[model samples]
Target: MISYEWRGHFENPEVNALHAEGFDHAPLADDWWGQVTRHSLGWVTARRDDTLIGFVNVAWDGAIHAFVLDTLVTTAERSRGVGRHLVATAVDAARAAGCEWLHVDFDDHLEPFYFDNCGFQPTNAGLIALGTSAPRHV
Candidate 1:
């Protein structure tokens, strides 16, 4: 069975590994998960048998809005309700924190998952690139 934590400690590198496999991104920065903890209102981690399998980051604008970011699960654990559980935990955390809105932005391929499974509504949104690369951020 999968277990979860509303954490007081971070598993930064392990979470980066999970993110790398789950999102098919190149290895993320070793300290990236640290930044997530520093910025988050709260986060939830999912595990089974002491191995990290999933994570979700709940970041806020310090007012009424909270965004769900970097929801991930190990490739072997996908479609097994890990994503759903992580998002649900994040949403619950956001609500408990008194956030008035919970938002998420995801790629097209994940629309059904976000909409059908996680109950996010479709809305008009936009993105603007302010730099060629976030080279400093990685």
Candidate 2:
């Protein structure tokens, strides 16, 4: 069974290691960890048998909208309810914070999953991010 907890206890290297295995961004660089812990509404992790299996995060202005970030489940733990649970947790947090909307910028493939599973739907006009120019490729 999976269980959820706020505050990832990043001091635990195992938790950081697990994230490395499953996420686009991982291993929880010190600056990233500090920023997320300091700026996000809260961060959550899912665990089974003391091993971190999944995680999600909510970032909000603390009074309005909240964005879902870092939603991921370890390969070994997918196909269970971990992703749903993470979404549920974010939803609850957003509602509690009096957010008018919970927004996510996800890959096109996720539209259906987010819509059917999390009650999210495309807006008549969705958001866009514009920059003067793309940053130099690493």
Top TM-score model: 1
Writing each residue's lDDT as its tens digit, candidate 2 over 1-138 gives 778877655554654675677655657644546767779887778888777787787888877888888687888887777888888888887787788888887778777668877788777656444676745544
What does candidate 1 score on TM? Answer: 0.88
In model 2, where is the ten-residue run with the lowest total lDDT?
A: 128-137
lDDT of 1 by residue, 48-100 (tens): 87888888888899888999988988888999999998899888888888999
Quote the lDDT for 33 in model 2: 66
- Candidate 2: clashing pairs of residues: none
| Number of residue pairs clashing in candidate 2, backbone atoms closer than 3 angstroms, sequence gap of 3 or more or interchain | 0
Candidate 2 all-Cα RMSD: 3.9
